[model samples]
Target: MSKQASAAIWLWLAVAVFVLDIATKQLAEMLLVYAQPVEILPVLNFTLLYNPGAAFSFLADQSGWQRWFFTAIKLAVSIMLIVWITRLPRTLLWLPAALALILGGALGNLFDRVLFGHVIDFISVHWQNAYFPAFNLADSAISIGAVMMVVDVIRETWHDWRQRR
Candidate 1:
């Protein structure tokens, strides 16, 4: 595909994912009470929580400095990703798409952080009573996209190595 077409596709995908993420988060906020856990299965649950910090609640207990810090970081990262995506090679659609997913997800959470001082998380999973932290669709998409990008990179490296041998 042409570079313009590739960039356009990634841009559209990012917008779609961002919209879905925001809609789902809105639904969670409307339907669930803060920190109220609702079991979906033996190993899965929904529990609303607001994260004011980065992943795993980093700096969650800080005296508010972390909030703006994370917000600024996310904003910078989102802008950088957009620029990087535009310059990406047309054949590396997977990498750009992955970056777009991460960008969209980051923006989704950043919106919450800016508007509500935290991120809205609701989906939860556990084993027995050992509960995993609550998360949302955007986080899942980012994680999946990152994993795929890593896989793609590893495969490409291996291919290059074989060709060089």
Candidate 2:
């Protein structure tokens, strides 16, 4: 059988995501005032914020070791994903796409953490007095990619069970 194309081709998607995330973050910073909300809807606003730690501001209050810690983790994860994507067959689209997204997002946030000492977050979601943690395009991409990966695993498991039945 002819060798199938490797999913490394999907790395382009990762590049696109990374570029877009960076562009949007820059634009948000330029257009939005820090900590000042620009309401776009009843539940959504653009409010510039910086995250020095991982999700939900975890370890943000620490003296500052978490930056390098998260940076190391992101580097490791991005490298592993690149290798895995290269080994996967292009016919397996969802998993590769998911990996690419995650790689892009990781790089985006890593760029911010290294250059600015924090991740730029501008998208705010709220319900009256309750507000969700501020996040950016990179965070959204990572979240979507993670959800896709979980769904793909569930699908594969179900397929395997059905095949055995």
Candidate 3:
């Protein structure tokens, strides 16, 4: 496919993911309202939580400065990803799409932090007595994007190595 077409595909994928992430978060905020955790199954639950820090509640207990710091960092990362996506080769569709998803997810969470002082998280999973912290669609997108980028890198490296032999 042409470079323009590939970029368009990535752009659309990002838009779809962003819309889904924002909609789910809004639903969580409106319906959950800091509600008590609701168990969906033996290993899954839904709980409303607001995060003012980065992943795993990094800097969650710090003074107010960390909120702005994380917001700024997310904005910077989003900008960098957009620029990098534009420069990506047409054949690197998978990698560029992954980056776009990560960028969109970052922007979504950043928007919440800047506008609401925290990110809405509602999905929770656990194993017996052990529980994972609640998360939202935006976080999931970022995690998936990161994993896809790693796979893309490994595949590209292996292809290049084979070509050089």
Q: Which candidate leads the pack in TM-score?
A: 2
**How does candidate 1 fare on TM-score?**
0.93
Between candidates 1 and 3, the one scoring higher on lDDT is 1
Clashing pairs in 1: none
lDDT of 2: 0.94
Q: Model 3, stretches more than 4 Å misplaced?
A: 1-8
- For residues 57-98, write the lDDT of model 2, one tens digit per residue: 999998889999999999999999999999999789999999
| Candidate 2 vs candidate 3, TM-score winner | 2
Global lDDT for candidate 1?
Answer: 0.85
> Model 2: how large is the Cα RMSD against the reference?
1.6
Q: Determine which window of 10 residues in candidate 1 has minimal summed lDDT.
A: 1-10
lDDT of 3 by residue, 110-154 (tens): 878998888888999999888887788889989999999999989
lDDT of each: 0.85, 0.94, 0.84
Shift of residue 153 alpha carbon in model 2, Å: 0.6
Summarize candidate 1's per-residue lDDT along 33-84 as a digit string, tens digits: 8888887887888888988878878888888888899999999998998988
| Ranking of candidates on TM-score, top first | 2, 1, 3
